[model samples]
Target: FFAGNGNFYTFVVTATTNGVVNINIPAGVAIDYQGNLNTASNQLSRTFGNEYPVYTSSNSGGTISPVSASVGQGLTTSFTVVPYSGYTMTVSGCGGSLVGNTYTTGAIVAICTVTATFTQIATAVLPTVTTGAATSINMNFATGNGNITNIGNQVNSKRGIVYDTSSHALPGNVAPASSSYPNKVEEIGSFNTGAFTENITGLTSNTTYYMRAYSYNSVGYSYGGEVSFTTNIYPTVTLSGYRIFSNINTLNVGTALEAQNTAHVFSNSGDSFRLRFLLHIANSNLSVNGGVFKIQYSLRSGTCDTSFTGESYTDITSDTPVAFYRNFFSNDQVLLTTNANDPTHNSDTVVPQTYVEKNNFSNAIATVPMGQDAEWDVSLFDKSVMDSTSYCVRIIKSDGSLLSGYTVIPEFTTATYKSRGGGGGSMYIENIATPGGTTTGGGSGSGSGSYLTKCSDGIDNDGDNKIDALDPECHAGGTLQGAYVPSNDSETVAPALPTGGCTQNCGGGGGGGDLGYWIRTVYGIFGSQFLRNSMMGSVIVSFR
Candidate 1:
């Protein structure tokens, strides 16, 4: 060491296969050993160390082989990190934020040290929201620590962001399809944390709508997603008039009034419909003893042969016979006038007063129109009679056409007695002698009595005792019984006189006609048979 000098000392040596000859120098002195000494000769020389390259046995302290230390802490404590390549041997804890580098060269040290640091990146911000023009706006939070009130307003800035309200309008501004329409929407409210419940109102009967949610907070208003819905409509019906049979002529006798027919239908729902004619009637007098009205007609054309007289009249040929029975007085005559006049007029007398006989009854019938119905009105009966009397008004249908038939009236009742011109003996004697004279005799059988004799035949050759003047039974009974004087008139006469017979020996003389004169004693067949059993002549009485 030298005074007042910051320098080092050094030494130099010359070496060969022999030994090194060193020349020492003082501190701060520069020594130059420039002479080249040859040690090739094998002469006697001092022993020198073996030839070796410039080498260092141990590195001194503070020897940083490559680079300098960085700015941040680079701790390498055993509790923190294991030693790695390029790590410094002086650190005890891991380093803080990385700043620069500090490299080393020798074999890796077994100490812990700081190396590098990681950087953080920022994310995009949520989009702004807007208020809805219609119903209340809503908002919601997706994935952030902030307000989630207005769910519709807070549109997510990132993907998977969404908001919704439970209620929505129909597609066409229409009310909901449910029975409860616009009012139903008001139940739910608007919100954020979860999906919003927005109940809108004031919707039309049938309309559609479009909407979206809106949210607002310290950040701003954010718009939600869009959606739409539709509602339902109703149905209605219309009608024309409710008139059924408003103008029916109820007072018209023997006339079947018109029935109720047309109608209208309406509906709200789209459905198919149709209708049919229905009829309802009250109590009627069209029957005997409340019996059903009779329709006396035939589909074929011909008169109904109710009488067994074998007389062929006209035939009935009606398709839809709607005729009903009616009652009338026995003396009533169905006049045949040829003119189609009113029922009250003489011109309307189609058939004159003939005793509305069986053959004199009407035969017309009627039928209703197609797709139409038929109804009847009957008159009430005052008294219940033993014999059934029927008068029919028939309506006919032929090949789909309507034709009416005349009504037929028939009656039966107790026969009444009617006085003619003479007594029993005179009438009998006159009827036997003359072909058609009465018993009121003359001196030579002259006078109206002569005419009566022509009809008075006790034999009943024509099956009519008073011998044949319009005897309906002539066409009925043949050659026996008395005459058939149809009681169409108020009075009808009996063919045989009430009293006539031979007073002596019951013979054919003595101012008496014959024994057969007493035959009138028996009225019924049993009485006549009893008379015959007694060995006396059987007598059947005339219509008394």
Candidate 2:
């Protein structure tokens, strides 16, 4: 017998043999009321002694427990249903109710079928990222920035910047390791989907670098567009101050000569001179490289001006400055001392024999490594002539560029010595007691010690009311002696002798009556000696 309801059809067959029977349906053998042709069905085999017919289940994108089972008429059965990852399940054709992952048949009377359907689950895609331009770029460090618009389906395991000296392709779908890309920086705190920053360090100065922002997750890494930035040049070198040494004496002690017109006096021609320039490095990671030093000088007829703008000078080439390489000492070790020894003393070696000359300017008299706050010393011989010489220094880099401003040069003057004739003599009058209880004779003078010279003496020997250094003749005659002293040694002259009788005592408590006797007594002693020296052809009388 055959019966049907819409697309559901059933057939009942009576068993006549005790053996099994097989049934098969070919493709397009049957048609539904909606004019849809039936597809091929699997062969069904049944034993005649079985209690009920077989129910069959099939699935796509999923699986079901108990794919086939024999059930009694008017009874129910259940099966476990499972769907693949990223899919969902459903049952049809077998009139069943599904709760959770279990599906139960409504009553089975004949052979039926169960089908499980699954559709893919929608998921999030890769994240969107952007790379920002470099900020706060300097000699050794810079800041990198990035933003993550979306984080994708997985949490980011790593996020930061990747940089290199050369341009490169985008990173692969994995976090880049140091071996593959050497320069990388990661944020220190918690990961953020929005804007973030990474402080990149250990960079080289005056170099161009390429970079990109990147983010990583289970789906792999995502990168922003490439960007480039060049670091700034090394920090500018500076001159802190300077030291001028005339042998062991420090000329500019306790004062900065650059701000004043302090004089450096040279005592003798045999003395050696040196200059120590205090150099400073503004940044700890930077250094002043190989460079040459030059000393410029000008001869001034009068006093030197306090500032460099008031004078013109030429570079010194006759006594060329020599650059030295100090072997073992650091900058702080040599510069911090009150009086640093000359660098040429022991472990120092002259680097190059001569410095570079350009445009008639002997730019490099000495070469120095001004890597830190150090004493950059140069040697100079003493001046032979008496002149007021002004000096300044200039520094040049290896590329012939000026480092900074010139060092201030003070006016240095040579000392003067007194000159006298061959046959000069000095007359001494001792034991002369003045009314003021002070003695004056063969000594410096009353109330004055050896500091009193003929020009500084208080006497008006020249008969001009102006006495000692105040006298015009004292300063007008010879060369200037020192920074503040007059050069004329013979400016003072003896006063005229008394003609009338001594109105005062002539020593020994004698009055006017004993004046003639005392005068002859003084004449008899010194007069004969003066006559004999006069006959010998030369006589110079100096009375004190």
Candidate 3:
């Protein structure tokens, strides 16, 4: 039985005979839109526009017709009253109905007609859930007479549920955010677009989840359909630093410097560059030394702006105990001159050598030493130079014969050593004394010093009777290497003489420590060798 007309109750009809249809409405009962009872009316009804009717009829010696009713229409509605049996009642607000009549023992009998209503339950639609995506679904309801309200609790409870199973609406309600880079839950938005989303983060690489949506209205809670999705896979690679090398074994200074410049100039050169990888590592410090380092770099098919050359060398192996960083070392480099006979080149063309494949610094820095002549000579490429057609300077290896990295500076051009002054070449010697020291300068050339010598006379000045160039003991060579003087070798009154040779022996030296007598001797060597008795002694020497 079901409620009808707010107070009327209708009984479900069962077939009595093969051709007889029975309609039974219980007295004083009504059916609400749902299965609940509505007691306001003892009559139940519905109206059909132009499509309501008992189109087909099965009769066991009976006749049937339609009927109607309305609200507050009080009538003792029973299951046996029929219109064909002369039972009539007027009730307003009622719609389609049915009436039936039968004849029994030559007497007419009528059966009452009953109406039944069907209503639908409300429901929601759920969207598919992904491991790293925003999710949402809609909530909806179905009721015969529109009696649902307040749909908040159901949707909010399961708003973020992103996983599901047969028994559970979502096996994993809480999932990682959509962006693992930022790694956090983000409440994006919840509009009428049929979903409420909260971004999840920190998800494992490859995983899956199931999800469903739920909603609540004034009527009841409703649920949406379930969905599932999977995440993608990624590689597990750990990237550190890079290393470069030239000439194979020794730490290539230019290669290491280029790797450093790649970071600053190129910006896209990852963290490191390498060649002939001696050791590849990370997390440790690195350094370079021991060669004339020249950094040659161009702006990707453009012009190169600067060059470098190492002067002094230092060894900077890892300071830390651990060798976690890469190490690169290369042999020293030698520059080739085009004017001279070629060593590393054939005719005038410089052949390229083996590719450098490692980074010299574990930290990716080109450590240039101090006082190095670090500059680049730009090649002026006027149309006139192209017309003349020449080559540039080339770089050679330490063996005076080995071929190595690129050499394009001094090959076919006359710009070699122009930017750097040489010939009476600029000597860069280390550990030389500071300026004005006893050791004036340190270089490849020899040095000079000052000394003193005795003057000679025609007389037996020292009583040895030696005179002029003929004196064996006094005159041996033309000039003295270094010596001290004594006025005892000459009797000459002194006037300060300009520096020059003595008349007799320019090579001979005298015992020193005589001040006045030495002054007299120098005066006599350059002027008159005649000194009074007051000036006669040895001399002390000093260097200027």
- Using TM-score, give the best candidate's number: 2
Sorted on lDDT, highest at the top, how do the candidates line up? 2, 3, 1
Which candidate tops lDDT? Answer: 2
Report lDDT per candidate: 0.24, 0.49, 0.25
| Model 3 lDDT on a 0 to 1 scale | 0.25
In TM-score terms, candidate 3 sits at 0.18
lDDT of 1 by residue, 128-203 (tens): 3232333222111111112333333343322111222344432221122331122222212333344334444333
Each prediction's total of clashing residue pairs, residues at least 3 apart in sequence or on different chains, is 99, 0, 71
Q: Looking at model 2, how many pairs of residues clash? A: 0
As a TM-score, model 2 comes out at: 0.30
Over 150-248, each residue of candidate 3 has an lDDT whose tens digit, in order, gives: 333223222233332223433222233321111222232332225344433334334554443433323333334444444333221111122222211
Model 3 alpha-carbon miss at residue 145, Å: 34
TM-scores, all candidates, are 0.15, 0.30, 0.18
RMSD of each: 37.8, 27.9, 31.0
Off by over 4 Å in 2: 1-127, 178-181, 233-544
Q: Judging by TM-score, tell me the better candidate of 1 and 3.
A: 3
